[model samples]
Target: MVLYKNEPLTGHPCSRPMARECVATLPASYFSDPKVFNLELQAIWSREWIYACHENRLRMTSPLEMTLATFPISLCLSESGSVAGSLNALTGKPDSRRIHTHVLNGFVFVNFSDAPPPFESTHVGLADEFKSVEHVFTEAEFDFWGHLSLPGAFNWKVFSDNYNECYHCPTSHPQFSKVYKIPSYVVDAREGYFVHSVEERQEGGKAAAASNASVTELLLTESNESFPMEAKRLYDESYSALNQKIKEYAKANPPRARAKAHEGGLFVHVFPNVGINVFGDFVTTLRWNPASHEKTLLQLEVFVRKGVSEAEMLRFSNFLKWVEIEDYVLCEATQKNLALGVYQVGVLHPFRENGLVHSQAQIRKRLVEYVSQERELKEKVGKQRDSSTTLSEESGTLLN
Candidate 1:
């Protein structure tokens, strides 16, 4: 009689120790409490390096005016062609206060703090990683395709919590799951950011071959009559013109080899509100703009290679929109539940939800420090008040 031995199942290395521990998520108050949100605005959003825009958007003639975490900022190009930032006062004048600005691989970042932490030290590994792929960001290699703004009626943290983990991708994003392998997805927490790695689904030894062939066939065989009229009306250029541009671009510049990576796609979420999604043929950035404690505007900026077709771009955009809508529904529903005043805290799955755990830890650390300082100040003020009262009583007794 031959007996077979049972084999042990192994998971991703980063999740092994986390699987052994049960962690608690942040309290519901963190999501719905106005006081906590205000604290965060001072602690996290105002202090950290917030992604502003790509360098391509900055003009020599005029400065780009925008708001970061409700603080007005004007990004201008100096004589040396480097970016400079200025804080805008309530009266629409440029304040004397300095706004720290840093550009990494064509992506611009700004900090509202007076003395922000050193960008290199804060970013550490992330800056080095961006430098490695700096070639792809050059004007000769890729172009800024466009950007999309998606407004949501949920707290910014809710949206961030959703972005930090892929545990819900299988259930929440079916189309996205079909494109990437879910079980192999991993999110690694770095110094000041989180790295998400996922491999594309393969068929017959080729990455994304199935999806690519289907999309190519759809683009070739489909007639213009079936094109969505709404899309045509929304976009300034016609399908034919876009297709011609794609062909011309392809002829001018042949497709080059992409940067090497163990996984097919890599996504980096910097502290606060920046997400960089890096793929072979294209890249997209996700920026979260907090309009209020309960409202967030998500901006997606797409950059594509020289030869990517219009149909391919449209398909990718539609897929992203579908995923965004699904996440928006989830975040808004979660926010409503949080505001119900019933669920105070929840447990997290150590193995599948470690990314969320890391994000909450970062937030909790900042809020905890703020709370500590606030208590200390209150105690000091109370002591001073009591001393003054005692002194007044003694003075009255002496006068009597």
Candidate 2:
């Protein structure tokens, strides 16, 4: 499928599905095209929320805040409740909109939102720190030889598009697929999702309160209350606590694990940058290095309870590392393939690819709104969540 930015499906700067038939049928050569890669860059990753880092990166008061492939975007964690991230102003494109936040990712970057600094600065020379860090743009750090490309190759979306579904899981990732089911066109995701929620954390207070009686946890739909509370409130009651309820239900009615191995934790990929995957007892971060168009790197960090044994934690850590190796290998291969051709277009799966589809839709809509002459897409892009899965609901409580 040769994809052009201003073509019919894209309708000048974007295109969409039903045109997706070519996605599966197109050979590897199609996706390898440089022109197609460029089009994908313009349409996808540019404006979408690409997860760069989590709160942990900026921990130390005078620590090096690195952006994978790019140079370090010096982070100053001062005693005062202000975080000043310094970049190499010379290389940074002044006009570029520093990705203050990946609006689509939904979690407002602490930089933009009201997430105040937990600690304070006990130092001086704030301007000097900004002077030292080399920034391509405030969004991306400068790296003479790193992964972040000003127009990162093919855009990280290619990796994300690949991750959203398991259509290729039966073939590509056999090990993990053996333990948990992957949703394809024919199968429903209720089971895969069911397995995790069953094991996930119960809220702060209630669990096993009533083994069999009726309980209902209603999440009142409210917006922008604070971090953690999220959009819905899961006030557990007599009917069911949807988050932990999935676990109790799954256990009583165990969803068949493709195999007996449920070693890993939940990994609900939040597009553009952040992905949360569970491995045993830890939640891992899958971060990408955006140096340039030719290369990108991804890193994983796992967090677990304070008192857990290291050996126990390593069990899932090793497993996730192996799984990540699979993804990284694929991403590298895809990059190689994309670097070769000029017109390959990938299609989004209507089922397993809610994130990909939502991302593309938002991207197309945004491109039409921001770059189009006709101003055909002026509609605002509210935070997009794949309502099909219980992630938003789960994360709403957990993050809060």
Candidate 3:
């Protein structure tokens, strides 16, 4: 439920002092109010690291179009490999702001704030961590496929909530639950990013293979070979080449970071709106691009180690598409309810919904700071007005 008007936000849900209490979800207005959404765009989204396009999208002669809080931006590379950004809204005008850029493992991340926290400090160890698992996506071993963009009728946070935790997966996504061992799921929450992972059930690979075969057979039957096979075949060949390269590298080297023998999957959620899912066979990305208070664009990208079969590739794509559909349906319904004003707020399950608590708390915290800044600005203006009035009065007296 929403907090009482007189109640103080003196404690955080993550803190021991407030851990036992029925912590309230963020207010309905945070997800439903246009004014609140605009403030979030200015405060949170503008300052956080946003997943821009992959590095391969840019070229020395061409620029990749981007947006920050709906303001158009562009990123281009020069012949010497230097990257530059053009903020269209401030283009050709006297400006002190420059977009910040960080390229990690070929994924381009941008921040719009004049001074975002230093990339290395805010994202400490992540670059090295991802690099440790670079076999799956190192430029020499993997190639970028195409991307999928789907529009949904819901606040971006709705889908984010769905993705953050999988307590609902067993009931909502049976197939996904079958492959992902929900009980072994662990979360490592950090200052700027969160890593939530699940051990892959031993039986999952076989089950997933069966599912893929069925999907592929059905698709082939339905299309009667009309499905675009040429492009898929090309991808398969590229994957095969990648597989050989991986084998050679593995023979020459061992895993840099050794862990107990476990076939687990890992996913990292970067603050604000990007998720990276690393599975056994492929790496997938989900980016939530805010369209409005009630709309978000879901961008999905799948990358596989170079040597995957055509049927398997198709299967993975189909599976992801199905997953996206399921998520969007629930997110849209949740958004409708959130907008109905029928519920003010609800309580979050301390252990299961900790991600929601942290994320919403971050949102509320930034908003409160913005409000404080606004109040201070107003007070300064008021003082200036009084000071000017006093100066004019003294001048009149002296003249008289």
Candidate 4:
């Protein structure tokens, strides 16, 4: 089932039970309409568990600050290490909005809704998957170096669609393609979020750890050796310095075998917003917030084990900046094209674009549920009004 350019997919965007083909590209209005955006803001953004920041920020500062659904919320870490999030106000009494907080694996998550699902239940088996990094996460030994915020002219979902899949890496990111086995990348759509993994495929169809090399190993091996001499020299210099740090880290804290065999590094997309990308040695977090129908504010932060060397930290920061810049360019261009009105929808690769597919499905599902609730409330209200009118008319007739 294919849809032509500018042709509408059958059924309303807010309709329940959308066919797979119709969901390939969301209606352009989903990205542009203010009303639809507000519906999503209330339905999905305000209710779901949003990935905010790491606990390290709380350690460095009393109240970790952030914005959610246009509200300026300040999160404070109590003496008990329990996080309390509150909305700020300038005058009058404090706002009465409830801010729910949940901390998992040293990562801070908050929900604007009064209640959200338990983190463990929502995430399914993610805790077991992170058992290998218990020392880094559970011990709170990771340091939050800094964050880079990139504002671009694209809907936040557009950037999400780009980040969730690696299908375009071969043509779009030559440097990334060199290190990552794009064909082997896959996303596991959990109940509330998606987990991505990359692994080399074996002859028997079983997944292996990139031929026994983890992400860090591949980074140290493939990237430095495959690039041109100029790039190679820079990498060699960087590695020569970073190798000392690695040796010290290993000597102090010997590497432990991962509890679970998830093959490559893990990248998690926690519905609607937070993106946590974990490499073996370091982790990069991405926060997506919508500024307008056509604009989004993205914050990218890199974190490493508490005592990582400055040289090694700089390498990860530089790599993130370069790759994210590439993504910004692509997303910005795509946003412009989307606004041109020449193309309203486009087909997605059935196998490769499943991440985008799952995300869109989640979005549509929430919208449908919201719409259904609204409809039911409206009908109930109408019935109450009619009953009240009938009672008034009968009283008047009896009085006459």
Q: TM-score, each model?
A: 0.76, 0.49, 0.76, 0.73
Q: Write the per-residue lDDT of candidate 1 for residues 1-400, one digit (tens) a residue.
A: 1111232113422221233456788878778866667767776887888899887667423488887787888888876878998888867564546699988877889998888888888877776666556654444566766666666678999999899889899988887888778898877766677777777776422344213343431231233632244433323232334435444555665544444422344588987898987665678888999888888887877777665654455555555555765676788788888878899988777657766777787787876665565546657767554554432332322122
The TM-score-based order of candidates, best leading, equals 1, 3, 4, 2
Task: Decide which is better by TM-score, 2 or 3.
Answer: 3
Steric clash pairs (candidate 3): 239-306, 239-307, 240-307
Every candidate's lDDT: 0.68, 0.37, 0.64, 0.64
In Å, residue 16's CA in model 2 sits off its true spot by: 16
Residue-wise C-alpha lDDT for candidate 3, range 1-400, written one tens digit per residue: 2232232223322121113445788777678877667777766788777887666657423577755457688888778866667666566777534588888777778888888888778776567657756654465544455565666789888888788777777777766787778877655555666677677677775556534253432232234433235423433343344344434543444333223222234578877888987765667778998988898888766665555555555566656644555576678778989988998988886556656766777777876776566556657767554554432332332122
lDDT of 1 at 247: 46
Error of 2 at 36 (Å): 7.7
Index of the highest-lDDT prediction:
1
Please report, as a residue range, the 10-residue window in candidate 1 with the lowest summed lDDT: 1-10
Off by over 4 Å in 4: 1-23, 89-96, 135-139, 200-264, 383-400
Report per-prediction Cα RMSD to one decimal.
9.9, 20.3, 10.2, 11.1
Q: Which residue pairs does candidate 1 place in steric collision? A: none
Tens-place lDDT per residue, model 2, 1-400, is 2232222321212122222332232334323433333433433344343444443434423544555334335444446623445433436567312223321111122122133222112112222222332121121211111111112234455665566555666666665565554542221122111111222223411232212333332223333422133212221121122234333333444323222222333444443455544443244555654445455555544444333332333333334434554565566666766666643665555435534444454434443443342122322444444532242332222123
CA lDDT, candidate 4, residue 52: 79
True-structure lDDT of candidate 4: 0.64
Q: Give the TM-score of candidate 1.
A: 0.76
